[model samples]
Target: MAAIVPVPVVDDLTSPGAQQSRPGLRASQSRRLNAFRYLVFALAAVFFGLPMFALFRMSLLGSRPGTYSFAAWKQIGTYPGLLGSIELSLEISVITFVLMILLLLPTMMWTRLRVPRFGRTLEFLCLLPLAIPAIVLVVGWAPEYNRIERFNLSGIMLIWAYVILVLPYTYRALSAGLNAIDVPTLSEAARSLGASWATVMTRIIAPNMWQAILNAALLSMSLTLGEFTVAYILGYNTFSVKLVSISRNSNNPVVVFAASAAGLLFTFLLLLILSYVGRRRRRRRA
Candidate 1:
């Protein structure tokens, strides 16, 4: 029997003309995608940048028409309790961040390591606050504040409420971080090496999750600083509460706008810093 030789097959789609058109087709698609990306970026810039510009411009407006001054900005410190409210808000932000990290980090790590099955339930509980309206939360917290006031804690009591409000954001950030790393493997490795739980958490897990921790801290602090409803309902003079009070009581509208712009700028700076740090961390990891 004669063995027949196999014939080479060529796909029409891969013919010379088809091959020549493919690069042009890909180039066109690339151009369209880049254009779409630019369009999206422009829209985002307009959406976020416009309000911030208006706010800052309003803050700079002068008493007379067609004039501008920094008088309002200068007078931000003069408003009664303004500085104190800012200080109080900062304190609350710091305390709330610390408490949130201490309470949630350990619990989340343990749950992920020991009871992976309960992760969904744990996430649900953390995110439950997002479904609860701020006003409703305030109503529920009012009674608790009454008891807190008896101890003469004043504005400091807002820390607890702010922590609750920040939970959903903090949890999402931390959960993402935990998922990014092999928590169970790391924990087990550390344990096998005779490292205590404290050392494992601090020296091993915490370092790996720094980005997520920073994100959680930023969210907690920003929420604490900007929160109004709970603090107002609880009769605390937080930064946001004081901003409202100043807007209502002060004749100078620019002053209120100035304070608002300052707060917005500060939050923006925090975000910028977070972005910078995140970039640095990624570079280092790479």
Candidate 2:
């Protein structure tokens, strides 16, 4: 009599309420997530790009209050020390590239691939370079080098300095790459098939990790090519040094702007190349 009470049956696979609720919930989540991503991207662009854009505008305006001209650009290329500085920078960057590879290679292999005590020690030591400030490094090296060695140090010192400075960047990249690969498994497989560690590293590991290595190289190249304090301290008249000298010594705003614009464009081009390669490599890896 109690009004013929009845119990509701729960649907196992197909339920109208569940099915209807899911699409709406999914749609709402997707919209919010997309909106958040867009917001983050916009904020990042504004934060990083706005200052560079401002510098570009300043360079365009040159020394003049309200006019634009190409005179600055002409002066930039035609400057007396520009070629020497560029060559010097190239030399430094190339040397740094070589040294960077050498320094990073072993660290990558040992730390992530081997993971032995010696490898750990090497990693800890390598990290010291990153932990020390550039100014501090320059200071320490200068006194000890000049006093003890009593030898003439030229741009080569700065070149090595670039190597030291960019070591941390390369190390992290390669280390990450090594971690991504199955090192111990690869080694045992190669060994069982009658391959030495050398062959394993060069043939298998290095090739697979090539993209990360390249990424590290590009980072070192970009950083070393545009360094300032170390070059100045070492008394090397590099491109960045000449650019700063030009800007500060005289009111040749046009030339300064042109030089800045050139530097920005060159770096941007390198960055673009690196980004494209990195993306392609990532996709291939995936």
Candidate 3:
């Protein structure tokens, strides 16, 4: 006869005690998770908020020691060509955004639908700008811009370079939107229902990816507004270039800091709006 062996019994998860404990365990985990999230948020606020606060405070510093005044902020308009440079930057931003949408949207959609194999190549070309320094890009573009100058297109020429500079950002944004949806299925279904390519793009696809498009547009505009290297090297006075010029030329350099702080605040506001809009859109869709 075989020797009798003792086996350990497993705890039954369905038992009343075990079932009652699970809710308590989950509640404890939820509390811990909420606490951790709040801690991370507080840390982030301190990290970002402190620098901005310092910048704003420094911008308000007066000429005398321990004095503070808003004169620097008010005197921003006194600087020659400062307003013009701002206007030029805004024009470049808007035009660059439109061109990016027109150029990238169709190409990306068509490529995804017809020539998916070339997607990697296209992505590589779009991302090539990130690897090449702005100075190097200006060197390559100088000759072409010189040619363009003969046509009397002064600041307008910057639009071409701006579009290329913003490629990596816009491409990534559009790619994220594309990846979130079934492009082929959507395209085929629309086509099967007698929808034209234009209809498919403008009506079916573009509407669904508006958030990504808006994100790309805002990024392109922000980059254009803050871009210094390409515009400076190419001899254009964009917003960033204007700020640099003011810091170097003005006796009261505090004004430049004030303007910079204002620009930063504007960008932050745009980001906040983007977040709010995205959240509202998601809720509506849900």
Query: Which residue pairs does candidate 2 place in steric collision?
Result: none
Task: Provide the clashing-pair count of each candidate structure.
Answer: 0, 0, 0
Candidate 1 lDDT tens digits, 80-160: 788898999899999999998999999898787778888889889888887886788889888988887888776777778
lDDT of 1 at 30: 71
Error of 2 at 208 (Å): 1.4
Query: How high is each candidate's TM-score?
Result: 0.85, 0.77, 0.82
List per-prediction Cα lDDT, in the order shown: 0.79, 0.70, 0.80
RMSD of 1: 13.7
- Give the winner by TM-score: 1
Q: After superposition, how far is residue 122 of candidate 1 from its true place, in Å?
A: 2.0
Residue 155's lDDT in candidate 3: 83
Per-residue lDDT tens digits of candidate 2, residues 1-286?
A: 0111111111111223444234556777877877897999999999989888877776677445788766666776677887778888888898888877876696567555566667767767766765677877888767655663357545655766677777666666667667768888887898899997778888878987876777677777777888887777766788888877877887654566667778879978987766676676566766
Ranking by TM-score: 1, 3, 2
Candidate 3 backbone collisions, by pair: none
